[model samples]
Target: MPGRMERMRAERRASGEASFFYREVAFNADAVKVMPGEYFVHSEDLVITTTLGSCIAACLWDRQAAVGGINHFMLPGDGASDDGGRYGSCAMELLINALIKRGATRRTLEAKVFGGAALIAGNGALNVGQRNTSFVLDYLRTEEIPLVSQDVLGPYPRKVCFFPKTGRAMVRRLPPAQREAAIALDQDARRRASASAAGSIDLF
Candidate 1:
C-alpha cells in the first residue's frame, strides 16, 4: 500500500496541481510551496506553505470532506489577459473548483485569509495590498463561504503554513531580513506587471 505522502503526490500529479514539494526540515514533514500565481490542493497529511507581502493567500477547506487548498494572488481581478492564478478572480475560482473536484462541497467550505500587508512605502493609491485584501473579503462574502479567521492589513510580510486534511493553519510574521526579501519579491512582481502592460497596446 502507498504511504500518505506518496498517495498525496500521486493525487496531485493526477490533478496536475503539483507545486514545489520537499521535506520541510523545520516541521519534519512533507511540504509544498505555493508561490505567486500558484495553488495546490490535497487530501493527505501534508503542509502547504507560502510567503506573502502584498499578495493574498486564501486557504479554503471543507471539514466534512477533509479536503482543502490554498492560493496566492497578487492582483484583485483578471484583466484582458489571462495570467492564471496571479489574479484573485482566477485564483479563487481555480481553488474552489479543485476542492469540489476533490470531493469538497461549496456549502461546507470555510476560509482563512492571510497577508495583504502594506509593505510598500508610498501613496495609498499604489497600495496593492489593500486592493487585494478588499477583493478576497468581498469574494468570500459574495460566494457565501464562511470566513472563519483572518490576519491581514498590517506592515509586515507573513509566512503561512497550512495543513489541508486537518484545516490547521499557522502564520508567522517575517523578521527584518525576511521582510526585506518579501518586499523585494513584491517590487519585482510590480515591475513585471508594469512591463507587461507597457508592451501591450489595448484597443479602444
Candidate 2:
C-alpha cells in the first residue's frame, strides 16, 4: 500500500484537477484573520476551498448582479469566547458584510452552505461536525438569510469548489482515509488554538 505522504500527494493532484482554475487567495492570522467584524472583496473569478471536519462554508451570491463569494469557518461564535475568527459567527459575518458591500441586500442574496462533516469516529455530543452544522443553520435562520441550498453533515469529508462569478458550488466527498486526514487537520487546528492561548507560535 502507498504511504501517508504518497496518498496525500495523490489527493493533492486529484484535487487540483477537481478544482476550477482561477485566481487564488488565502487568509490567515497575520493576514488580518478574517474576523466577524471585517470583510473583503475580489473582482476576479475566484475559487475558495476548505477541507471540513467541523468547519462550514457559507456561499453568498447576488444572482442579479452576477457576483458571489464564500467564507470558510470552524465554529459558530456566540460572542461567548474570543472566537479567534474560527467560528461561524466570524465567517458568516464576513461573508454577509462582503456581499452587502458588493451591493447585495438580505432579500436579494442567496446562500449555499457546505461542510460540517462528522468524518471522524465519534458519538453525537463529541461530533464537532454536527455542532458546526447546527450553528450555521441557527445563524442563518436568525439572520434571515435566504438559504438557497446546502450539502452538509455526514460521515464523509468533503472538498468544496465555489465559483463566485456564477454562484456555482460543488462538493466532493472524500474516502475514509481522506476523511481521517481531514479530522487530523481539525485536531491540528485545536492544538494550534491551545498553543495560541499559551502565546506559542504555529503555522499552516
Predicted model with the maximum TM-score:
1
Q: On residues 43-119, what C-alpha lDDT tens digit does candidate 1 reach at each position?
A: 88879999999989999999999999999887787744656677788889989999999999999999999999989
Model 2 scores a TM of 0.70
Q: Which stretches of candidate 1 lie over 4 Å from their true place?
A: 1-18, 193-196, 199-204
The local distance difference test score of each candidate is 0.84, 0.60
TM-score of each: 0.88, 0.70
Q: Candidate 1 local accuracy as lDDT?
A: 0.84
lDDT of 2 by residue, 116-193 (tens): 776655465766677778888888888787888999987777776666677887778888767667877776765544
- What's model 1's TM-score? 0.88
What does the lDDT come to for candidate 2? Answer: 0.60
RMSD, each candidate, Å?
3.7, 10.7
Backbone clashes (count) for model 2: 2
